[model samples]
Target chain A: MEMKSFLIIGMGSFGHHLCRSLAENECEIMVVDKDSEAVEDVLPLGVSGRVGDCTNIDVLRSFSIDLFDACFVCMGTNFKNSLQIASFLKELGAKKVYAKADEDIQAKFLKRNGADVVIYPEKNVAEQIAIAASSDNIFDCIPFVEDYYIAEIRPMERWLGRTVVDVNFRARYNLNIVAVKQGENVIPIPGPNYVFNEDEHIMVLGHINDIRRVAY
Target chain B: MEMKSFLIIGMGSFGHHLCRSLAENECEIMVVDKDSEAVEDVLPLGVSGRVGDCTNIDVLRSFSIDLFDACFVCMGTNFKNSLQIASFLKELGAKKVYAKADEDIQAKFLKRNGADVVIYPEKNVAEQIAIAASSDNIFDCIPFVEDYYIAEIRPMERWLGRTVVDVNFRARYNLNIVAVKQGENVIPIPGPNYVFNEDEHIMVLGHINDIRRVAY
Candidate 1:
């Protein structure tokens, strides 16, 4: 695979993390921050680093934004700075722009201004935790598509000893047991003969209504 | 389902969102914060609201902590306050406690202090976005269990017009097409004969390596 170049602005917690993750994936990165310490922190990641206030168009212009495959505006709390940088990146001909927003309202404004994608971390995580908390058996839930969800849940008593084929999972529960979580090990796409164990958590995919019917 | 009551402390963005989500799910909730305006913001959701510094044991004691099914500490930035409140909740015999943290280090400290679950919102979202951004075809990816993941991707050219059974998806690809996304509609658990289309995004469940092989 070819290496992708990324230009990252802001070195707050979110920016620091995004830089580290992209670097681990072996992407070529250039990090920028107003504070010298912030820019210095990610320099060891072996990418280019710059110290400048991104809110200033002159500082942004020095970077030659069009060279990077994508530009990330990762100011965690400064909505105004993030918005301004996102717009500047677009105006400078960055191929793609990703911005971080704290909530839905901020996401809309960021998209309208310049961001191709707005990542709302807090709101998404809050909703995920709430779904897990509100349920009796589900440990975690990820929304799939529309009303469908992928959920991690404890097996019901009746399913403890039965194999996937024996129980006819899809016909009986309207859910697919995509994987089985046994302690720290995850067995993906378990065979039809895979037996259900009491101590294990089953990762299933189905409509929300079907999941509720079985999880409850 | 029987109504479950929850106690939420710290009305930061995460807390505000958690409170609103739980209320929408019809769970009884009591929201607390040091700022009256923060508490008042969630009151319209018909939840009990209070303004008090949770770091004080006296203020926490007044809430009858044991009566709550679960307690959530939603302080966004103050690790000290969140650590203290989490320990206090456990000492007061709160059944379950959930706390939010920015990264792995804080998550560890929060869990050690008495949080039953630590929600690391920013880190989780950052990793997720990195996965999507790093790939060429994958639009989004969710870590399911161990090395398995649920990914949304544009169907391969070879897959268009071929039915699941015709391609022998499970045997040939070692992946499961759990759902098909066509525009806004998601057809979950599509039948074995479901045909792949060019304009549609397929949601597949597979090991990281298998997903990478197909996605790239």
Candidate 2:
């Protein structure tokens, strides 16, 4: 298979993680960072690492930016350097360019100036933490809509051996059970006759209130 | 402030992670698992541990299910047992119940049986991984529509010194810059004057095709 090529602008924590993930998945990676030590640290990871300023056009041109399938601006701190790199990538005719912005103003500028995608890692992590904190029983919460969510919740003690027909859950809670994950195995949308087990993880979907009610 | 209460039915990897995360946030937790060892393992983590069959009605009633704010039905392997638990929770008038289902049929059954939410862990994780792999520059991708997505892309070299107005990104790429997130900080909906730097993450909204065009 032809491996996809990627250019990562920063070699910070997020960048390092992304690089490792992609590399493990067989993607060809080219990394750039201003810090020589950072580049050296990742050299053995088998990715093409360059110690150079990502904001410099000459440094980018040296790598033949057009050959890359995509570019990831992983710089998470300085807003100015991010924009410069984004503009440079677009002007170079790279197929796609992604940048990380620290502030709303920087994000807007990147978008308006040709950055294809901008990410906010801190907000996403915080939201995940907040959601986990707010609901006591919810193991993991994924939003389906503003009011609706899919959550992994611990089963209440009362639900030990009753069948679906016995509960008439639809009429009462207005929720949906999507699937069940058991250990490494997955049961795709179990049948009505399926019996509940003690070590199973049930996947559910419904309104926040309804889910919270069952979760609590 | 009154802390919320939670009940975790299964003591698997997901359950363990959930319990630890919630407990860290100061939520009260009750853990129920068939394996005595599993319950004992997490006892020191500050969670109430109970070794009992989740499918038992007597066990369900003994937990004072009414007091729990929500419940997580983590049992996914045994569909029959999961269904029983879902119905039991509903019968007990637990405010909300969440389950992890491996199959679509299981989800349907859990929903029909009063489970407020159903989750498919494999499916969710698979989709997340797929998105991350599809785009070289995209570190994260959130789907807003079937054809549209919000992606976080790293900046490229060319865009280092330009402003939003100078680039005219919207007219060129049909992408929206929503926000930027720096390390531990978030700037929502940045404006034109905002500048881009090398070390920032920006949030952009656009169709997948457009996003790909700009990001890569």
Candidate 3:
């Protein structure tokens, strides 16, 4: 694999996590934060850091920002600082810029200014939590798309004796039973004749709406 | 709905977002951060705040932390401090504790120390980005389970004229189409007779492993 480099503009939660993830991916990462203490905290991760204000063009230029493969502007909440840093990264000709945004307005600012991708990590996590909260019966809720979810759900008592073919779950629930876990074993792609085991935990692929509609 | 109160330590991206989401759910919230600016920035949201070190048990005690229904520790990458704060939250009798981690080791520390839930936001984003990176044709990837993803992709040429019933996507690909977006129209549940439109964006739910097998 070819080596890549990144300049992370903050040491906040989102930026710190992204830096670690990129480091695990074997990228050369350099982090910057106005607080030298924050910079010092990340030093053990094998990533270099320096106390610098990313919003200043000179501070960014000192690090040769344009030469890095990408620049992560992770100051999501501060509108002025984030926008300034994003614009400067693009002006310096960074190959790609990824920014963190706290809201749709911030995302718009990042996109219009220069970000290649703008992510809202908080929103994503909250949405997942909301799904789990709403689907109380489901042990876990994994959002797939607008309405679809991949979830670990217990079959309603009425569903225990039916076989896959008898219910035609695909048509009835707009879902597929991808796997079933009976205690320690995972049954992937169970045959059509497979019965809904009362003691097993099934991985159901369907709309969250349909899953909510099931009468427990 | 029964309203709950929460104490959020570290007003970084993750905590700030979660705090906002919980506030929307009608929960009373109080936030803390060493950075006074961060605490000040979030005050407009109607949540109260105090500038203090979460690792300091006395500081936490001053806030009457145990009275809150739950607590969120969002100091990602600060292993020692995060562990201390999480342990202190439980010792103070907070009903639930959610902490943020940057890696497996940190997550383990949080779990062992007292965190009821430990989330890795960077890992979540990287997995989503990796799916998008690997499947160049897929526009979006939302993870549902260990191996499943909800993805949006352009229909293959062969699928353009076919109806859903004739294709039997679930059997053929271990996937289901939950919704489709054509221009401004979003079809939440396309009927069996629904034909794949060339201009539409189809939201497919399936195992990421199976989605990877698609020719497109």
Candidate 4:
């Protein structure tokens, strides 16, 4: 398979994690940051590090920025530099550019300045922590729609030997079974012929109220 | 906080993981399985274990089933036993019961037998593995509608300084920025005014075509 190239423009904790994760997956990574220490820290992770201000078009071009399939603008505090970098990356012909914003204003600016996607770390982290604290049975929760979510719930005693068609889940509980997890295996969009067994995880989609009623 | 009690009626690998995870979060766990070895294996995790047939009404009632906030029926095979257990749990006045199904037929049977929810483990696990194998940028992906999905995308350089209103993203890419993740935090339904920054993960909703186009 052809490898995807990624340029990460920050060497903070989050950036380091992303680089390591991507590298583990065998993706080629290029990292840019003004901090020499940060650049050096991630070098052993197989990332090509360039010590330069991300806002400077010359510095970015020096790294052959156009060759990267995607670029991440991860400078959290310096809004101006981050915005300048995003605009330049777009102008330089990068296929996609994602930036991180500290607040709503900064995110809006990034989007207006040509950023393809914007991220807010504070809010995201809080939600994850909250969910983790709220329920022990939830392995993972992903929002599916407005006021609706999909969650991977550890199977409880009452669900064994059940099938999707028999539960009348959609009608009775207003939740939909999207998939099931058994050990390391998964069954997606299972047909009516599927069966329930012990030690399984159910992937369900529905409003929070409906999901809460059934999942617990 | 008041500790919640959960009864997990299987001692398989999935059950073991669930018990450990729940115990780590400080919930009281009770495990029931016909397999003596399975029960013994998870005993060190501090879960209460019983080596008896979970399908037997006498066995279920012996545990004072009403005290449990929820019960998980996790037997994979032996559909008859699974169905009997679900029914018995409900009849004994358990508030909620979840079951695991090895196939669609079993899942249907469990539901009809009074299981509140049924899980298909093979289905959920496969989808998670597939997505994990396919993309490093996306930490997780959940389908919302037939063609639309929500994904947590790792921030890339081109998105810094952007806001929802500034990009007209829904119009431009047919994608919605639903939430943002930064570090270990999550922001649900972030307003349009939210800003993008570095080192943040983004929760986005859009058609698969659009999600693929923007997430990368």
lDDT of 2 at A103: 48
Which sections of candidate 4 miss by over 4 Å? A135-139, A144-148, A154-163, A181-201, B1-216
* Model 1 bad stretches (over 4 Å): A155-174, A187-200, B158-173, B190-196
lDDT of 3 by residue, A137-184 (tens): 566666655566667788877778899778787778777775677765
- Give the clashing residue pairs of candidate 1, or none: none
Writing each residue's lDDT as its tens digit, candidate 2 over A1-216 gives 367888888887567666765676567888889998878877787988888996779888888888987788877667788888899989988888877664457779999986887764433332343365565566666554345555676666666576554556555767666545576454433545556566776656567778877876
Error of 2 at A152 (Å): 1.1
Cα-based lDDT at residue A24, candidate 4: 65
Work out how many backbone clashes candidate 1 has. Answer: 0
Q: After the best TM-score superposition of candidate 3, give how far the Cα of residue B34 lies from its true spot, in angstroms.
A: 4.2
Query: Relative to the unseen true structure, what is the C-alpha lDDT of residue A64 in candidate 4, on a scale of 0 to 100?
Result: 68
Which 10 consecutive residues of model 1 chain B have the lowest summed lDDT?
B184-193
lDDT string for model 4 (B1-216, tens) is 478888988765446655665676567888988889989987898878889987668888899888987787766546788898899999999888878775557778889997987755443432332343347577777644454567788655665788766766657876666567776665654656777787788777666667767655
| Candidates sorted on TM-score, descending | 1, 3, 2, 4
Candidates in order, TM-scores: namely 0.91, 0.50, 0.68, 0.48
Number of the predicted model whose DockQ against the real structure is largest: 1
Decide which is better by DockQ, 1 or 3: 1
